[model samples]
Target chain A: MTTTTTTRAAAGSGSGSGKSARGVAPSGKPFVTFEQANRRLKWALLAPALGFVGLMIAFPLAFTINLSLTDAFGAVNAGSSYVGLQNFADALTDTRRFWPAVGRTVAFTLGAVVLETVLGLALAMLMRKAFRGMEIVRTILMVPLLATPVAIGILWMLILDPTNGIANHLLGFVGVPPQEFLGSVSQSLPTLMLIDVWQWTPMMTVLLLAGLTTLPEEPEEAARVDGANAWQRFVHIILPMLRTTILTALVLRGVDALKTFDLIYATKGPGGGSDFEAETLNVYAYGLTFDYQEYGLASAVLVLFTLFIVAVVVVLRRRTERSAS
Target chain B: MTQAIRPRRVLELSRRSFGVLAAASVLAACSRGPQTASPDAPLRVLAINHVWTQAISRYLPELEERIGRRVTMRMLTADQLTSSFNVKLNASATDIDVMTIRPLQDQMLFARNGWIADLTDRVEGDADYRWTDFQDAPRERSVTAGAAVSVPVVTERPALYYRKDLLEDFGGAPATLDDMLDIALELQRRSEGFFGFVGRGQRSGAVTQWSSFLYSFGGDFTVDGRSGIGSPEAIAAYQYYGRLLHDAGPPGATNMSLEQAMPIFAQGKAAMYVDADAIYSNFLDDSISTVTDTVGFAPFPAGQAGSVPHNIPSWSLAVNEFSLLRDDSWEFVRWASSPEMVARLQSEGIPGARQSVWDDPATLASFPADLAEAMRVNAANGVGHDRPEVMQVGRARDIVGRPLVSGIVGEDVASVAADADAEFNDFLVRDNRQQEF
Candidate 1:
């Protein structure tokens, strides 16, 4: 314990002074310098992680950028000539499929994330106190999360099938007309978003529940002593304390919602629907790559999509930091 | 003290032992030969999930005996096969020795890309192959640019499948498009919860089914290498198709592909379904279908022109260009396409491309007589290509199919057709430019 405290103090002082000096051990031997040792240890721990991340993320990003400038398409090994920004220009100018896909992507992400966050917060608040069958309720909440996305899509397909599905059969019991759920162009995207919310709301609930557990009871006690109502206490104290956690959840869910492919692909296929009504940017880019083999154009769309995601994250992070301060 | 000393000595000994074991395993792994197949090695074949391909898989023992090697088969859906083969062939992967091909959809594109090996010389060299024994339409469909790239396996034509009982009540099968539409509308008006017609309605996938309608109306997607979808005949075809489906088709028809549409017809919910004849077995099997005995096949109804259906090779067997065991692959393909195998497959109720199988007494005895007659007539009058033959076939289909879906949903037919024509022309021009490069 004495050695640990001394080493921490020495490390702190070395960082503060920005100097390279040997830290004297409790035993008074000439031990390693805290400044040099800290630097070496920091790099030693981070280098492998950074290398792995670079290989996974940076190489693909750089390759996408390079491919976006060329006319590489059709056969895998087909020779390509550098076209220089033509693909980007074409993508930006493509009003037929690209712009509509962008609109759908933004709409889908916003719809799913907002619904999940609100529903999750409400459930978390309700579950804050211990009650009977709490463990069972928690386990039940985890069912959707445990099932794979493709399985969820196929399950929903059968449930929502127009003529034979149980959804319509149940509706018939109540005298409601049979509705085309995933089959209609206008209803398909919203139905998919609802499916997304159903699967992911529990995840947000768990995260917010963790945050709720860590909250200080003293603040609520003080607020109650001051004659604050339940709503007032929640809004003024609990919400502010949970801002960072909310932002973290948003970032986690937002990125995933933005690039959702498997559910849509499994349910609707390449162009999304018959009229491409449910086509989002990620689906469009995938179709360009795999279906049409327009590699250069697909790369440009992906680069643009990545930039959009990064910009959204940066803004959210800034907001989080501001709230914290 | 002795316990501590013994633990240290044991740890050191175990470390050395582990090192020796790891070295021995590495040496054993390195001594194994490469994955490339020899003449005696098992042949790996990739096939689309279809009745014909499944039949081949079931008779693998016989195939093995004929080829003198063990056989393994991987089956995938048509869509899955196309996407996977595209990636695998592009990488020149030799993991798949033989694979199924769709001549109308993939023959030109794959042959142009040099992904499939040319089988012309092999066919010429084999005396017992009897290449000419295959039907003319299927043979032509399998050949691209004067080179035989694949051997036709399952030949199918789009035919009108209707309930014989329903049709008999409605004054028998309608002979023309107008008569068919009127009969459907009248039957729909009489019956509750019964749809009159069902076909594929998904974009890009519906184009092949729509081509027969387009052809019957004296319309073509291209005429003299130019876009003809905006022609008067084409506009009429689109409007007619829209009216018929909108008035009589089941709800949510737009989401229905052949896989979905076939069930609706087989369940007796719809009176008529026009699709590839390959799915006839689905309607005939009493285990899966309710309308087995009532289902009747007819050549597609006539319009401005006489009855014109798509007699195309739906599936074929092709050799991978990059396969290390090319000779072995050829042997498998040759065996699969031989007369004896074709006849055997036909006798088992699976369709075949060989003319000999079509004429065989046992084949005729086993097959549905009326359906066989319809298939023969349609084959004689069938067009070679179902959709436009181009490298950008998928894109072309999408361009044409968008208008078709819009028409079905009651959009302005002329404007949609015009837009599709413009986009199709642009695609053709772009494709031509790439070809030149």
Candidate 2:
């Protein structure tokens, strides 16, 4: 029904645009000659490109949504019947792993994005003044972003290795006990969030920096000239202008946090994930599809996950647009 | 449009005609495609891990040639083998022919679900297929639902490897469970920086190794394959394991696994470990192991089940139910399991799995003379117990491995054992069974 309405609106607007050109000289001007055929030709030229995009993106999404509706277990084709809402029901009610996975996904996204946004904002502000070796500092900051995630995970794995690792050895000299950095249930998730922050804060910082650089200086300088303190200037003058970018960074990092997989999986072996403490929603879905061969459940989880992301995005975008205005 | 009003145009194109032309061309290409690599064409068979590839390639290179097809080999990760392309193999029509499976996947899930093709009749009928060489235990473990599921590819059992130097300093390597206890105690008492033993006490596969001790102590996961790991023997195993950890093993061995143990043993920080012999190369390689010469192998401590070394599983080569090259795949399976291939590979100094090859003079000669003696002792006892998987064993592995890790970290023997056993029968079998439905 919505599709029909959308198509009607599209056609109405399209033909309305064409109608303006229907009469050769609507204004009865001597020099003007507009033709509907030329407008039709322009639309003809646009259709193939638009059709190509619709086929490439929209078709696969439609197919995925279709598959998501079927009860498709791995390697089972005949039994893939249309089980419309069963998969969604199962995801919401899955007692053992799925619900816990959703909880963890929320925690991970909130923990990572909140911490990263704050830290990134601080780092961006601190580095904005460009005091010393600024170019070199910026160059070094990109290293974490450039390194391969799995390799970074393994590198951390060795350093945080409990017995023979340098991390423990260094701690040993200080009379601090050797800690199970990635191995303990208590520490695993936070450790992963730490790794995420390390690798990605630079990205957030760069974004905020771009926003800060583009920020109007007149207000901040006006507050300063009026004898307003540095902190007051930041709060009243600087912060109001930075809300859109800050929220943009949060939503971007929030999405990334929910999908974080490589570092967690690489650092901890399958099923051995920090006492199952690190099993986030993405990891749960991955295990279902790849580890357990439950594609139906994985698709359901994905559908639900996509819905959650879209909800968060909608909420954040509204705030961003409000702040931008 | 030509204004002829001709029936010829309808015959030439008319969307249906174009579709027919396109489909015919597709069918022609598909028939000649690699997926259609007949018993006469080169069959692209995928093997999981390098071990499966080595074991299957042992016999496939020659056998497939004899079967009028050349079997091309591809190594896949175990995750890849279990999940993705096999579904596409039939529908999407890909090139993968035969693939690898394991007890974790093969037993009923592959056969009952018909993910793997039925080759029992074909495998039994093949002149080259040998059913007698493998002992009854391996065979029973290999088959599923009265049908052969896979050709047993890589088989292994764990052995207790220790530093000869650490043991000699502590009075000698353990010959019995009591001796192990005494050594662990004394080592804890004497060593300033040394740890007594290192094992996989982590939540994953480490829990399985810990269970081997419990099972060997006459505990069972289930009676008649039902949940029963809550017995007194299980308690005893857990208690003894906890005491051993508290009194002797490394401080955080509770979370240690192959990733940690291998490197620690290699660096001479860990004194003893019970793990796969496949990991021997990392410990015995002089370039890696600082204590290479000082390392020695021993029989794992005996429990009530006697000193049957616990073999979980490696990987196995199986013909896919959808596999096009049945005869060729069977030939490859047959060649991989034969005594000759085992002996030949052993001679080449690859330490993975080929039981018969250990007795080969050349293979024994390649090992350091002392380690060779140890290898002989291990070859006698080191095919560990078959994995405790039945169906949906992945869940069971997680459930049991978790409590066992909890047992390692702090719980008393009987309590943790009872907790584990109770959880297994209730949470895993009973709850999970209803849950799976």
Candidate 3:
């Protein structure tokens, strides 16, 4: 919901897709002026980075687009006959696991992003004023973010074990039956969300804190000097001014949440939480590849999953722009 | 009472020691060994059991004396073995000398693709290598052995563990599979959270456990690897299993794994459950299971024809064709395989790969009174050997097994089985076969 309301920042489309190769061919020719060449050399030095991005990101995206057309399991040589959008049809309607996995992916992303944005902004506001042991506190908060997700999942399993876990023991202190946390279908997805919140709330907090620190205090001061109180200043002035930063955090974190795999896989495994409860789109695709070797359908699922992401990001980008304007 | 020689804990940990290490350290430290082997380096052996804890903890002194070399052992999961060595054997020379994995997962693709070294010559002349002592059932599993590619480790299975006190409180062992079902239903009627039946129904591993029931009904995964999932018997089997879970299992039966099912069974929350034998050993310590002394075992209740249940295999050690250490590694392998080491295994309370090990009175004394009897019965009747993964079995299980079981409970069986048969047969193409059958 918040993603849709956050507009794309006012830099305009930054990608250089409009120019033709022929038009730049002469300009890209070897050996210009020494200073000009020096600038070109700088770009030439950056060529490796750009190439790395292409290999790692752009090329894979293009390859994924190609792979989306065929059945590509983990092994490249594993025989997969090319089937068009049949995988798409199978994933969406005929298959139960893939469709539910998509739904869980959407729910997890929404829950993680929306929660992080609210909590993170609040934490930023708290940290903005600073307090006793504030540095130590912030450092303590960041530890969750630093811990490996798989390790975090394992740690939580111990804490959440029904018989001997500290969580159940604490619950028993209040006289509740020891609850099955990760093992229960009703509890697993939410449990994973809780883990995501623990590990990533600090990431949002740090980002929002940076945004808050960068904000001009003058606007808040002016609002404060007016009839506006703390709540009003925050609601009307502070939030609106920090709108773009919050949206940026939303997009960055939101995309990561959509692709969240390590935590779920660690917590529940390839079938995506037991009974497919914790399975996100990534987990579904992976299970299809490794667990069942349904490469063709997995690729189809990926194709649809990629499209779903683009649609969400595009809608969010537009929403952010509208709010900014 | 005579001193209770606790079943040989692979870790030598008392239940109290487990109290000290707890689940976190145990699982974390579980992945404990492996140093990469370079040629001219100490022979690198990647062991999948207890990460080398069983070697380090259970048999270190003997392993040292027998090998006469400072052999390195690396431990990791069954899945890890699949991930690492499958590639090295395919890519270049691998340093791994011996690898252990579940027989079913010891895919023929590995040997078929030349990833496993041919071992016919290795088994014959090697003085220490003795193949005759193993159970004959797993012969189908060791097909890669043209001579001997893999050695049987232990039979990993989930036998029917019922409350003997409860059964004696009730009556005799259920005479038939339907009787088992009726007994479970009757148990659930007592308003006890303790169901007479417990299993995974989560559609992941649940599908596999459910298959064991199907097998008891005489269903098979293979019909020339084209899949017998749609057979009339299989549909009947799925319907029976589905109803058993729906009517008799816990509210969250669909989601239970060994981790969940074991606690309920231990706490008297579940009266009957079928799962891996690993739980039985862990439960016997008294700290984990208060009913340990009273627990009873039987072949998973049989069908009308009294067909026994099937289970996933416990892993055995196989030398990758790419492994260079078969010559040296077999020395330690032989020592470990000898009757003496098996006796040590029996002393520990764990069963060994050797059939002779089961004959030892000491080993029999280590387990509960009923368990020793059930182990023999199940071994006689149960499927301990590896059944090859034919055709798209991996696919059929997820696509057919999961859906079939679910649909039988939620919808129809005939249609589901038909759908499964079509899907399974479609997957029977040459390239898709993957050297499994």
Candidate number of the best lDDT:
1
TM-score of chain B of each: 0.89, 0.79, 0.80
Using lDDT, rank the candidates from best to worst.
1, 2, 3
What's the best-to-worst order under TM-score?
Answer: 1, 2, 3
| DockQ comparison, 1 vs 3, better candidate | 1
Model 2 spans with C-alpha error above 4 angstroms: A1-96, A272-274, B1-35, B38-42, B51-72, B76-93, B104-107, B169-171, B189-193, B251-255, B349-384, B412-423, B426-437
**C-alpha lDDT score of every prediction, in listed order:** 0.83, 0.67, 0.66
As for lDDT, the candidate ahead, 1 or 3, is 1
Which digits, one per residue and each the tens of the lDDT, describe model 3 over residues B1-437? 01111111132334475455554554676453453443455656777655223733456555665556567777776556665764455344557776675556544555554555555566556655556666666645765535466666655554777777767756756656788788888887423245767676655556656656667787766666566778877788878877776677765455556666677677665567777554576556678777666677666677854646553346666766655566666665666556676667656666666667776677678666666666676667766432326423345455556554464245576787788678667766643546442
Tens digit of lDDT per residue, candidate 2, span A1-325?
6545533454456566654322223244321111223344455468668757877988766766776788775444545788998888888888768877777788877888888888888989999897789988989998999998889998888888766679888988899877878867778778888888888889999999999999988998889989999899889988888888898888888877778888877877664373677887778877776656566777778778888888998998998888888
Indicate the residue-level lDDT of A143 in model 2: 95
lDDT of candidate 2 at residue B302, scale 0 to 100 = 71
Q: TM-score, each model?
A: 0.88, 0.83, 0.76
Clashes of 3: 15
Residue A60, candidate 1: C-alpha displacement in angstroms: 3.0
Tens digits of per-residue lDDT, candidate 1, B181-297, equal: 988887774224578888888887788998999999998889888888989998888888877777888766677787667888888888888999878889988987999989998
Residues forming the 10-long window of minimal summed lDDT in candidate 2 chain A: A29-38
Winning model by TM-score? 1
Ranking by DockQ: 1, 2, 3
Interface RMSD over true interface Cα atoms for each candidate: 7.2, 11.3, 25.7
